[model samples]
Target chain A: MCNHGIHIMEEVKVIEIKKSIFEDNDRDADNLRADLKKRGVYLLNLMSAPGSGKTTTLIHTINRLKDKIRISVMEADIDSDVDAIKIKEATGVESIQLHTGGMCHLDAEMTRQGLDNVSIDNTDLVILENVGNLVCPAEFDTGAVRNAMILSVPEGHDKPLKYPLMFSVCDVVVINKIDVMPYFDFDLDKCKEYIHMRNPKATVIPVCAKTGEGIDQFAEWLLNEVRNWQNK
Target chain B: MHELGIVFYIIRDVKKVAEENALKRVVSVVMDIGEVSTIVPEYLTDCWRWAADKEEILKGCQLEINTIPAVTHCDDCGKEYPTVAHGKICPHCGSTRTWLLHGREVEIREIIVPNN
Candidate 1:
């Protein structure tokens, strides 16, 4: 049947494309930062390991400063709406929950998606409680104006030495559960030294989320930081 | 793991490229992962294998990782050293005024298609 027909060869083609994997997320984060700045919103990305008392500290912070500034919370977890619900019932402020569908960390794009879920434009403070993980969250920029981490006393003081990247990337470090410092072998001064060794510029705030021992100071510092960020 | 999210991003970008080029299938995706970057190549490949095969075009697509050695440049000493070995401190001059030169890369170096 093909006696008079010409034979044609199927050719495979190779296309070359080089691009950064985080390119889209990074660009989105930058844009989100700019948008937040224009809208006078200060986003604080809070990260830490599981059981770091991030929620307790955030609740304390919200309780202390909600009257002064409009505060909203975006709680991200692998699978749980409990934190967001607790934040709402406890503080009576705007709250949203983000389920990562099993991812251990929140990237800039995920942060932006969460921001879109809530009213981020009108709020003065947007606290992103990132998924409770030490390693992955530090590597992803969540488009927050500033980044902080909560290191509880129970988590040990050598966390900085083990997770240097988290300590180095954070702008502020909160040493939570300081009320139990007497029971644990954690040394505050030594922890501070370790944090400084990793990041000299990080502002270390010691607090007890349970007793609210240093929540006032922490709240004051956060207020000032938010105000300063907005002013800038 | 966050590597799973990254694998999704890779699949998205690769599919977009394949669509634009009118390609039917992809062979492999080469990535330049930094030595100091938080992404582990093994985990990335594991996630890739799980996620990429779900896509019709990326079935059995190989994920090749090219590790970029972490390097840091010292501002005070004007020297470049391995970042993973010495960290933020300059080894030659013992200066803390050092910044990363390259090690945070998580980029796709090449998208390989069958020589179709």
Candidate 2:
């Protein structure tokens, strides 16, 4: 029995490898960012919950900026090409859909695959509409030059306090559905304050996607972002 | 679902390590999962069992998780506290100016392989 135990112990070996699971993904993301920078392609990863007016806001922003900049859109979903069709039909820009095969979020590798299908050389900006989730998407960087998120008024001002990680990572936070703020208890000032609490430098843009109100500001921000990216 | 996605990443990493060492079969994978890492241990292991079995090298590989307790540092009071209980706030001083020092890690500590 002692010989048997020794034999079993000898057959098993433990190797020390203290590495973060996200390390590989993070490295891939950095490499992708460098490649995009070399190509002068600004990839914006837009994330938010489902029904947060991401598609509508994209349509409005694309319509405003398409004339000035060569734009493309990549809509990521578990299943469905509806968003891809909508963006193309509404703005007439090159748009494609990426199905995540029931995955919750798009990692850097998946984003790279999606970018392969788009005309990166001809396009100045590629806005990737990430899977509609506030949790998982924030954890995985999609190698975008910048990260943005939408928070509809109905989702409440307390969202920033709840999903702190999501708010913290986003460079810009677009507060949508502000037109209905009068009916709901969503306080605009409080929402901004909460967002600032989580992320001091996060630019908060409030817009009503349904009425196209305050979309010009968002468009202006995107234009400046794209211009700065190209020049940098 | 999120756990399943993480399992795929783990599998990929382990496979690369196995290839580098010329390991034919992985006996077990040890992980360091933080308290606030947002990964449920139960869900992670369940996902691991399902995904690891599909891979030839990782067939029947055991997944062992070490829970790292989350600790937050208070910038105001210069004290430390448990993050899971206080959560972004310093409980001793009631200050909102706090940051997580650790416990957001989803790391692979090591891998157990057969000797020969």
Which candidate comes out best when scored by lDDT? 2
TM-score of 2: 0.96
Task: Give the TM-score of each candidate.
Answer: 0.89, 0.96
Candidate 2: tens digits of C-alpha lDDT, residues A124-157: 9999999999999999989999999999999999
Indicate the worst ten consecutive residues by lDDT in candidate 1 chain A: A1-10
lDDT of 1 by residue, A39-129 (tens): 8999999999999899988998899999999999999999969999999999999999999989888888888888888887678999999
Candidate 1 CAPRI level? medium
Question: lDDT tens string, model 1, B9-67?
Answer: 88988988889888888777889999988888999999998999899998877788999
Instruction: Name the docking class for model 2.
Output: medium
- Each prediction's RMSD over C-alphas, in Å, is 5.1, 2.5
Candidate 2 residues lying further than 4 Å off, grouped into runs, are A1-10
lDDT of 2 by residue, B15-105 (tens): 9999999999888899999998889999999999999999999887888899999999999999999998878778899988788899999
